[model samples]
Target: MNFDTKHIVILTPGFAASEEDSTTIPAMQVYLKTLIKATPKLNITIISFQFPFTTQTYNWNGITVIPLNGKNSKIKKLFIWHKANRVLKKLNLENPISVLHSFWIGECSFLGDKFAENNKLKHIVTAMGQDVCKKNRYVFHLRKSKSKIITLSQNHHDILLVNHHLESEIIPWFIDKNDFPNLKENKIDILGVGSLSKIKNYPLFIQIIREVVKEKPELKVEIIGEGKAYFKIKRMIKTHNLQNTITLTGKLSRIKVLEKMSESKILVHTSTYESFGFIFAEALYAGMHIISFDVGARKSIEEWYICSTLEMFKITCLNIINKIENKKTRIVLNCPENTINLYSNLYDSNF
Candidate 1:
């Protein structure tokens, strides 16, 4: 009922369960939290379409969180649309909703597009990572709403342009400098950070680790993430007898991940594809040497070596390991706020 504050609706797959919830979507938790701090006048309603969400309506730093399946049910997915439409109707009656934005090009985009069309509001959808590369049927809607789509990097832009023939804008991710720690320590030889998904190519990371240990017997390799391939990657480590050299920490808090990064020497990112590799940015900020597969954040991160192939990655690692292994350096990265502010202004403008 407050006309003074503009209401913007955001549809996401899942959000942090609460302000203190760090296990899910940590980057987005930090992102929206920072965005709210910078822009206090906007009222954000985050509709998390979590199939098995435990909580219903809650407050996250003043933002309203409405989870779809707040209670566990067998047929929750069956009635998701009905639940979403009911919420949308209630929201429209309460306030003049300005914008409907979705983070992915799938179901959320469908909901946002429909809501925007029916309510006569602005709709924007973001194509992230494999969403643009994979065969997503809903992405066809972006061709009609070409200007309203925002991607993460030029690589993604090119992919969208070539794959789907959809021209869009770019908005890179930004890190708040206040969050990083000022620690200088080297406890690990090589580090791989990301989920154990097929897209991350963790098996290839294991192969590289196996190769690296042959040269450096005393090397320490640690992977800090968890996914469906936990057992598969564990099997690889066991089969290769890398029990001493390689260790998987299995999903730590964001602060702990950054702390672990600060204590590591090198970060090896072997992802098949990424729109904006936020982990690389965090690693470079922690001053760790990075050997990535020329994906997102490859051009912006300092002291990061890009490799076209896994062989090149191994060669680059062999060349740089000893020089920086003993010392942990904190690289001063320049994450501009212009783009971030532009996004904030766009959201405020309700477009």
Candidate 2:
């Protein structure tokens, strides 16, 4: 693949819908905006299946947004591949589309395969985390057919190799340093970010907080974001009498969450798997210590803290607070530009 391509299309399932202020969504927008800024000649378009009202033409940072509409049913979603396949064909007929990039390999990227086959478009699918981590039998064929899958961590690459029986290149998620404050002294108690779901392992978080408070009795933990586990998590918080220590902020704007991250002393991530740990990297960049269970891209993080299990996680948290008292944590800012540039080079070459 050449390292310089001017036109491309990205197919995504949907942007995170947190009243338009989700951290995940802004993180994506920031990265895409940076790509646009770096390569002004590049024309990028995002086609989302979730948005029904997207127009034939709309603009953000010189990039185009196109949404395809179809029947209102699960069948409609299944047939989106046909709709997108036709649209890309028309696009090729008029202006010769370049690369077709799929953000994840399952449904959204399935259309990319059809588009590539029909129009000879260069196709690439970047698997985030869940698509590969959580196993399901229904998409077995989809897993087998996909080629050129991109992953963010070596573990993710290994997961695909072991389970899906395929090889994938690593393309770590990027974070714009300009958007993050430099690592400062720990001011707040503890921080947790991500959807409040089982895979995220929120119960483990509650358990760790309770253990830490038993010793110090003053330690506090804050959880950000909302998910199906809201009520259950609230019940646990109340039952443990952690109302004074643990706070579920529900869903908040990206900036507000960042504000909380900036003030926090430690970040506790308890996911079973991660394609790449975005918030973990962000916390490290902000100069806060992080202690995460051995899941996802936990090993990918450089220069910080880690734990093997929920029990080890509690011990690690205590040590982190003690280190804060001793003032001995060293944090560094690692740039994702090299990784992003590598992917861009690959895209250009494929195009």
**Candidate number with greatest TM-score:** 1
Question: What are the per-residue Cα lDDT tens digits for candidate 1 across 1-351?
Answer: 232567888888778876666667655666777777766777889888863365468888898988896343446754776787788889989977877878878778887888888777888787767788648888877666622888877888888788888877888776666777876667887999888888999988988888878888998999989999999999999999999999889988888888888888889999978888888768877888888876775674447888877688778778777573444566644354665576766765545
What's the TM-score of each model vs. the native? 0.92, 0.88
The model with the greatest lDDT is: 1
Candidate 2 lDDT by residue in tens digits, 166-208: 6788777666767655445555678989888888889888988
Question: Each model's C-alpha lDDT?
Answer: 0.78, 0.71
Pairs that collide, model 1 = none
Pairs in clash, predicted candidate 2: 1-349, 1-350, 2-348, 2-349, 183-286, 183-287, 274-296
Backbone clashes in each candidate structure, one number apiece? 0, 7
